[model samples]
Target: MKSKPVLTILHRLAILAYVVFALFPLFWLLKVSVTPNDLLYSEGVRMWPSRTSFDHYAFVIAHSAFPTFFKNSLIVAGSTAVTVTILASLAGYALSRFNFKAKYWIVALMLITQMFPLVMLVAPIFKMLSPLGLTNSLTGLVIVYTAFNVPFATFLMQSFFDGIPKDLEEAAMIDGATQFVAFRQIILPLTLPGIAATLGFVFTAAWSELLFALMLISGNDSSTFPVGLLTFVSKFSVDFGQMMAAGVLALIPACLFFLLIQRYLVQGLTAGAVKG
Candidate 1:
C-alpha cells in the first residue's frame, strides 16, 4: 500500500513538472504582453511586471496588418486541415481494409518523400509555382500546406483505422451496405479522436509554418501570422511588447480549436477503453 501511494505521488509530480515545463514559455509570453514597455527590461527577469497595459494588444489589433495575416492564416490552415482530412480518410481506409499490389510501393514512396529535406525542394517548388502565378497567393499556400500535411495525416488515420475491427465493416456489409457506406457510417464515426487529432496536427503545422510562407508570400495582403510577426522587427530596434501581444493573439485560435475538438478526442478514447 505504501509503495503504491508513493509511486502514484511520483507519477503525479512528474506530470505536473512536465506541464509546467511546457507552459512556461506561453506564460512568459502572456506576462510580457501585459507588461508595460518601459518596465519590460527594467523588471529584470521578474515573474510579473510592476505595471501592465493593454496598449500593445490594442496597437497590434488596430494599427498593424495583423488582422489580414490572421484571416489569411485562418483560411489557409482551415482549408488545409479539411482537405487533408478528406483525402487521408479515403486513403487510410483503403490502406487499412484492402491488400493491393501497389499499396506497398505507395507507402514506400510516402516514406521516401519524408526522408528528403524540405529545403532542397523549395527552389524547385518556387520555380514551378512562379510560372503559374501562385507566388504571393493564399491559394498557393493552402495547396502547398495540404500537400505537405496529407502524408502524415494519412498515416495517422491509417493507424486509427487499423485499431478498429474489420468485423464491424463486414457485419455492416452483410446487412446490405457497400464498403464505402460501411466505412462512412460505421468506421469513420468511431475514429473521431483520430480525425480531431489529425485536424489539430495539420492546423497547428500549417498555422506555425513560416519558411514556405516567407519564401512564397512577399506582400502583406497574403502573409500569414507567422510572417506577419516579422513586421515588428526593424534594423534599429525590436518591439518586444507588441510582438508578444501579437503572439498571444496568434495562440487564441489554436487554443480554441483544440478546446472544441477535445470532447471528441476524450469520447474516442473512452470508446476505445470500453471496447478493449
Candidate 2:
C-alpha cells in the first residue's frame, strides 16, 4: 500500500519528463517562428523573446515559393502512403495466411533491402529513373517512396494481421463469403488500427524524406517541402525566421493526419497493453 503511491508518483514524473523532451523542439520551432529577425541573434537563446512577430509567417506564405513546395509534398506523401498501404495490406495478408514457395527467400530479400544504406542506391535509382523521364517529377518520387516503404509497411501490417485469428475468416466463408469478400469486408474493417498505424508511418516518412526528393527532383516546379527550404539559403546567411515559420507550417498536415486517425492509432499501438 505504501509503495503504490510512490510508484504512481514516479510513473507520472517519468511521463511528464518524456512529454517535455518530445515537445521541446516543436516549442522552440514555434518560439523562433514568432520571434522577429532582429531579436533572433540578440535574444541569446532566451525561452521567450522580448518581442514577437508573425512577419515571417506572412512572408513565407505570400512572398516565397513555399506554397508550391507544400502542395507538391502533400501530393507525393499522400500518394505514396495510399499506394504503399494498399499494397502492404494485400502482401501482408498473403504473407500471414498463405505459405508458399520461396517465402523464406522473399522475406530475406526484404530484410536485405532495409540493411543497405540508402545512399548506396541513390546513384543507381537516379540512373534508372532518368532514362524513363521520371527525374524531376512528383510521380517519380511517389514511385520511389512506395518502393522503399513497401517492405517495411508490409511487415508492420503483418504484425497486426498475426494478432487476429483465422477463425473469423472460416466463419465468414461458412456463411457463403468468398476469401476476397471476407478480407475486404470483415478482415479489413477489423484491421482499421493496423491500416491507421501504417498510414501514419508511411505518411510521416514520405513527408520528411529529403535525400531522394533532392536527387530525383531538380526544378522548383517539382520540389517537395524539404527540398524547397533550400531557397532560404543563399551564398552566406540562412533565413532562420522564414525557415522556422515554414517548418511550423509543414507540421500542420502531419498533426491533422494523426488527429484524424488517432482513434485507431491508440487502439493499434496499445492493443496488447493489458495483456497478462
Candidate 3:
C-alpha cells in the first residue's frame, strides 16, 4: 500500500513535468502575444505580463497580408493532403496485396525517389514547372507538395493496409464483388484511421513547408503562411509579438483538422477487418 502511494506520487510528478514541458511554449506564445511592445524589452523576461492586450492579434489579422497567406496555405495543404491520401491509399493497397512483374523494381524506384534530398531536386522541379507555367500557382504548390509527401504517405498507408487482413477482400470477392468494389465497400471503410492519419500528416507537412513555397511562389498573391511570416522581419528589427500571434493563428487549421478527425482516428478502424 505504501509503495502504491509512492508510485502514484511519481506518476503524478511525471505527468506534471510533461505537461509543463509541452505547454510552456504555448504559454509563452500567449504571454508574449499579450505583452505590449513598450514592455516587451522593459519587462526583461518575466513570466506573465504586468499588462496584456489583444493588439498584436488584432493587427496581424487586420493590417497584415497574413489572411491571404493563410488562405493559400490552406488551399495548398488541403489539396495536397486529399490528393496524397487518395493516391497513397490506392498505391499502398496495391503494394500491400498485388504482385506482378517489375513490382520489386517499381518499389525500389519509389524508395530511390525518397532517398534523394529534396533540396537537390528543387531546381529541377522549378524548371519543369516553370515551362508549364505552373510556377507561383497554388496548383503548382499542390502538385509539388503532393509529389514530395506521397512517398512517405504511401509507406504510412501501406503499413496500415498491412495491418489489415487480405482475407476480408478475398471473402468479398468470393461473395461476387469485384476487386474495386471489395476495396471500396469493404477494405476502405476499415482504413479510416489510416486515412485520417495520412491526411493529418500530409496536411501538416505541406502547411509548414517553406523551401518549396518560397522557391516556387514569388509574390504575396501566392505566398503561404510560412513565407508570409518572413514579412514580419525587416532589415532592422523583428516583430516578435506579431510573429507569435501569426504563429498562433496559423495553428488553428491543423488543430481544427485533428479535432474533426479525432473520433475516427480512434485506434480500432481495422479491428474487425482482421483476426489475431
Candidate 4:
C-alpha cells in the first residue's frame, strides 16, 4: 500500500493541479482585461505584459450600456432563482413526501423534458411568449428561465428531501404543527444547503443564458450579460480588451453569491445526520 504521507501529498497535488487548471482561464481573463490594447498582440504569449492599464474597464463602465444589461441580468437571474426555488421546493417536497397516483409518470415526464435539446425548443418558446407580450421583457426572460430550470431544481430538492428522514416533520406534527408549518420551520432549515445550491445553479443558468435571450430580446435595454457580451463583437473586429474586462466584472456577483451562501453548502452532505 502507498504510505499515508505519500498518498496525502498525491491527493493535495491532484487538487492543486485541478485548481490551477480551472482557475487559469480566469487568471488569463483578468490579465488580458488589464493588458493595454497596443500591447495586446505584441506581448504575444508572455504571462504578463510589461505594463497594464484600466482603460478598457474604464471605457466599458463609463461609456458602454453594460449597466443596463447588468441590471436586467440581475433582475432576471434573481427572480428566476427565487421563483424556481420556491416552486421546486414545493414540488420536490410533494414528490418526496406524498405518494399519489401518477407520481411515477410525473417524474418520468420531468426527466423527458431534460432529454430534448434546448435549441429545438427555443423557437416554439419564442413563438408562444411573443404573442403574450412576454418577449423582450425581463419578466418574460424570467418565466422562460424558470420553466427550463424548475424540473432540474425540483429533482435536486427531491434528492435532498430524500436524505432527510420523515420523522423530523412527523415529530413536529405531533406537537400540533401542521405539515406546512413543520416544513417551513424545521425541514427548510435542514435543507439550507440544497436551497442554496438550487439558488446558485438557477441564478447562474439565468445569468448566462444566451439562446433564449438572443431569440427573444431584440433590444439592448432588456439584454442580459451573455447577450451584452456580443455587443463587443462587430462585423469588422472584436474588442478583446473591453470584452475581457466585462467578463472579469461579470464574475464578481457569482463569486459573492457563492461566498454568501457557502456556509450552507458546507454541511449539505451531512444534513439530518445529527438530527437522526
Q: Which runs in model 3 stand beyond 4 Å of their true positions? A: 1-5, 272-274
What lDDT tens digits, residue by residue, belong to model 1 across residues 1-276? 356888899999999999999999999999999999889888698998888899999999999999999999999999999999999988988898899999999999988888878889899999999999999999999999888888889999999999888878888999999988888888888988999999999999999999999999998999999999999998999999999999999999999999999987875453543356
The CA root-mean-square deviation of candidate 1, after full C-alpha superposition on the true structure, stands at: 1.7
Task: Judge candidate 2 against the unseen true structure and give its global Cα lDDT, from 0 to 1.
Answer: 0.93
Model 2 over residues 1-276: C-alpha lDDT tens digits? 367988999999999999999999999999999999999998697999998999999999999999999999999999999999999999999999999999999999998999999999999999999999999999999999999999999999999888778877888999999999999987898899999999999999999999999999988999999999988898899998899999999999999999999998666543443342
**What residue runs in model 1 are displaced by over 4 Å at the alpha carbon?**
1-3, 267-275
Worst ten in a row by lDDT for model 3: 267-276
Would you give me the overall lDDT of model 1? 0.92
lDDT of model 2 at position 133:
96
lDDT (10s digit) by residue, model 4, range 1-276: 657998899999999999999999999999999999999999689998899999999999999999888889999999999999999999999999999999999999999999999999988998899899999999999998999999999999999989888887888999999998999988898899999999999999998899999999998999999999999999999999999999998888999999998998887455445664
Tens-place lDDT digits, model 3, residues 173-263:
9999999999999888888999999999999999999999999999999999999999999899999999999999999999999999998
Q: Rate the local accuracy (lDDT) of all candidates.
A: 0.92, 0.93, 0.92, 0.93
Residue 136 in model 3: lDDT: 94
Ranking of all candidate structures by their lDDT, best first: 2, 4, 3, 1
Question: Cα-based RMSD of the predictions, in order?
Answer: 1.7, 2.5, 2.0, 1.7
Per-model TM values vs. the true structure: 0.96, 0.95, 0.94, 0.96
On TM-score, who's better, 1 or 3? 1
Task: List candidate 4 segments past 4 Å from native.
Answer: 1-3, 268-276
